[model samples]
Target: MPAFIPDILAAIAMVGVAYNLAGAALAGRWRDTPAKRPAATPSITMLKPLYGPEPELAVKLSGFLDQDYDGPIAMVCGVSRADDPALAAVPATARTVIDPARHGSNAKVSNLINMMREVDGEIVILSDSDMSVPRDYAARIAAALEEPGVGAVTLLYSGRGETNGWSRMAAAGISWGFLPSVMVGLATGLAKPCMGSTIAMRRETLDAIGGFERFRDLLADDNAIGMAVRELGLQVVVPAPIVTHSCTETSLAALAAHELRWNATVRMLDPAGYAGSIVTYPLVWGLIAWIAGACWWVPFVALLARLALAERIDVITGRRTAPLWWLPARDLLSFGLYVGAFFTRRVDWRGAQLHMARDGRMTAEPETRYP
Candidate 1:
């Protein structure tokens, strides 16, 4: 059994090589758009779903209000109550809706659905309250949203840090680990992801999927929405990745709570795909071989594999240099989270407790008003 370990390592190295090669191609293809003044500006509605004010919330809110687009933009913010501290300094053009009405276990989508009634524009760009983007955000979204045969357009994000060690790790996990993986999928035509960070679809197409109301109970509502759009034979396009979110988990527990739920959600949504993700972690597998003292080749290949992915991701996302050694630490932690995911069948989101089933829908434990 110990002698065969090198064989396993070599096979795992193959997965690593495939991703790095694909990531290199993806990086080359991941072009950044020059800030072109839009030829013509179309009316746009920025749909924002809010729970409460998070760290740097005000600054994030300002990104949308400060856009340079030549189109009429309506900022629609919704809260579960009349006074979600998030309401304090929202600019006037931004409309606010207060509705405690729970549409389902997915509160964010519920909030978005309530706010959707306020939209009056040719293009609808849905972004989360904690997310921030550039001045060209609106114009870029408009171009993608206007494309024929497009159902949705979502952005890829990197971290905006708060100076904590673990938070940076989590952020790196997203920027280096998650973002490039998504880009690789996009380049290979192997993915259709519509993220809450930014999902701009025609108001009409949103209705065709039965709206956000249809995703009220889905755990991976973003992925489900994207799939629904694809079912309609339309592509969910993600052009020139945009920075749209940040990490706020300060403690290890906080990080685990935040990511574990996400892990379980993804596993539930794609069990086979989730199982295949084990190869994404070379450190843990290499450590197993080292602890057993079977083959020196395992650790050597693992180190090479991880560093290659990191380098590829750095170039692809235009993200800065990471402490190369920290990649292994992040990979081990991610592997731990992936293992915990299989055993976790419940999720706690936005102060709401939910039980995850084999399918991707969440059932509230105590049962919320909508569940």
Candidate 2:
């Protein structure tokens, strides 16, 4: 390792930092200047499939139940087991169904299939158990999917972790890193993801692609669903942005497991894109600079780049919730996660030992090993 190696690495890191800055700017623009589209037909069925009770789950589910949309609106929330606590928490405005049986490896989609039979709206939107939305969520999603060829619509979410310290950090990771990165990808036509946060679609288009059951075994179900719509030569659109529920990680181990599962899931879906994401971690590259050369200036540059990113993220995503001292440590940990993600092939998801296949199927390992 030579001194010049660090300088080169630092230079490389600056490029990525600049790219992220551009992305942050784009997110701010998207948030501030949401495309104003006239309200369309508002018949929508909001599907939420849940398995457990989470902190603030009541308030989150209630947000959708009390939507301001004037047209027909129905909600079909499912619980994997009849005893799952999530069903009771849903507001009475939405129809609730209890499904104890698992159709395939994917319990969420299984619940979706059961609930879909009961949905009675022209427009359908499915989200996870943890998402929270504004009163106009249904109206906006309906409007976004009004175009002739639009198959599905998704939203980029800013995290809201209301729990503990680690949970807040995890939220920041979503708001600051994942959200902004996705914005950059969309801005550049490099990434097209249909997120579960808010996947709006016409009932006909879902049927055109063989319905949600097609995603039963897929790990990145949302992405696969979006791709299937794409195969129909239909466009998957993303609305301005949405605020989804985020729980506190509560511990470093919890944060690690959470992010690692996500990374492995992405890797199984798109290996090339996952591998290329390394350049996005300027903090990691900066560390390589310091480790390779013992260069004092390399460390300073790393700190500067990281601080710039942190402050920029706060400003762009409207996330100033994190305390002053946590940014530095968070940046370092994020960089480490970026590097380590490349080597992980197995992840623990919902107490399941999931080994990611080259394709997107999450094959379960024996529960005994993980337990």
lDDT of 1 by residue, 1-371 (tens): 66777666656755765675566566655556676455668788888887765777777887887987888888898888875777875767689888888888788888888888798887788887768888888878777766678888888876545547777777777766677677777776766678878888888888898888898988888888889998999998877745646787788887788889988887787788778877766666677756665467666766776677677666655665457788878887888888999999877786778888776777775433321
TM, every model: 0.91, 0.92
Candidate 1 weakest ten by summed lDDT: 362-371
Q: Poorest 10 consecutive residues of model 2 by lDDT?
A: 362-371
Q: How many clashes show up in model 2? A: 3
Each candidate: RMSD to true structure?
2.9, 2.6
Clashing pairs in 2: 166-249, 167-248, 167-249
User: What tens digits encode model 2's per-residue C-alpha lDDT throughout 116-188?
Assistant: 7788888888887788777777767777787778889998877777778888888877766787788889888
Candidate 2 deviant stretches above 4 angstroms: 33-39, 294-302, 365-371
